[model samples]
Target: MHAATTVSLIPVLSDNYVFVLHGGGSGAAVVDPAVAEPVIAWLEERGLELEAILHTHHHNDHIGGTPGLLQRWPQAAVIASAADRERIPLQTQGVQGGDRLTLLGRHLRVVEVPGHTRHHIAYVLEPQAEEAAELFCGDTLFAGGCGRLFEGTPEQMLSSLQSLSALGTSTRVWCAHEYTEGNLRWAAEREPGNSAIAERLAAVQQQRREGQPTIPSSIGVELATNLFVRAQDAAALRQLRGHKDLWRG
Candidate 1:
């Protein structure tokens, strides 16, 4: 079996996380880079070469760093949703759901998750040997919550979340933002008696107190504790989304 791909996080902007995927070699790929200076510094310091830039959506915060990174590594491929070419024009490779790609020697399958944006997409790195699977789900799904309905309906978000839920329990979810603490706090308020939410909130609180990222959450964990993922239907998800939009804590 091939060595498992290594994913490194570089926190940028206020709460966004840029993911760097690399294996045993110096070639690496970045996902949803909010900025480039830090990402460039990270790669240069490690002597890693940028081989590709994977965009989950065309949101500025998600794709703003592409131009700079392309300038630095002109040969790196820009992969994004084909339906969103107008917004994410730098994409050298336009892809859609079910498209397969081999980046940094790991196989990735695209999964359409259009809720945060009409053309939002995710990349699932198939598990190899003993390593767990990886999902780079931009702003669609969070640790204990989901992205707001910006350009899609509740039904679409529900469908998107359901599709992601089927990725298996062991898949490691790498969402773009650092909104876990707030998401869990709101979830605990909604499900006051849920021990899973309560316990996970406590653990996450400790992790935040230590300034640690609560990211790379497993699918099993989200299925158990995330209110959005556990919602029964579009109506339930809509209600939850509305409540979360107004929630201050």
Candidate 2:
């Protein structure tokens, strides 16, 4: 409804990507800036001021740019999960599950998706449109795979995935990475004959070959092909996580 608001994803160091979500220009809401230079340059180039920052987790790669960003726009609010207060102490406004906040005129509902980290959260942005929604899941959920359980149990991760899966199938998933090809490769190896795995692998491979990002995945796509989302239960999720962890390819 808001003229297809543009959310630019800027690839930072090696595998990290910081996203800038802004509506009709002038100001932006950044999500997980891994570094400051690129982000600062991007905003300055566009003559945009950072209005707020929504962090998905406390990973150094995720929050590393906060200090520098704040240096440019000191009044901008840093939003993060309340549970990780000590870890993400710089967050100006700590939030939790089921809470809603207004950003760029849209209502973002926080969904506690603890798997990569117990405090990891996904922001389901309810744009003022009739469509399903959009999610900024960070490392918890990826295009073809999910982040490893670093601080939470498989049961909690499975529950988190379940919660995410419950979102409308059309919701757009903005995961912070260009790892779709690698994850699909690993999945295709496990489910050798599976068409879903094969097709996704082919598509992602093509994207990589062309040097294009295979992100902004839809919930429907993940529901149909993401192996992690297909996990039956906690035990299965744990086993899958182990396999993925050791998966060299």
Question: Each prediction's TM-score against the native?
Answer: 0.99, 0.96
- Which residue pairs of candidate 1 clash? none
Q: Residue-wise lDDT of candidate 1 within 103-213, one digit each (tens)?
A: 988899999999889999999999888888999999999999999999999999999999999999999999999999999999999999999999999999999999999
What value does the lDDT take at residue 56 in candidate 1? 99
- Give the Cα lDDT of each candidate: 0.96, 0.89
Tens digits of lDDT, candidate 2, 79-110: 99998989998899999999999887778999
Candidate 1 global Cα RMSD? 0.7
Supply every candidate's count of residue pairs whose N, Cα or C atoms clash at under 3 angstroms: 0, 0
Q: Candidate 1 local accuracy as lDDT?
A: 0.96
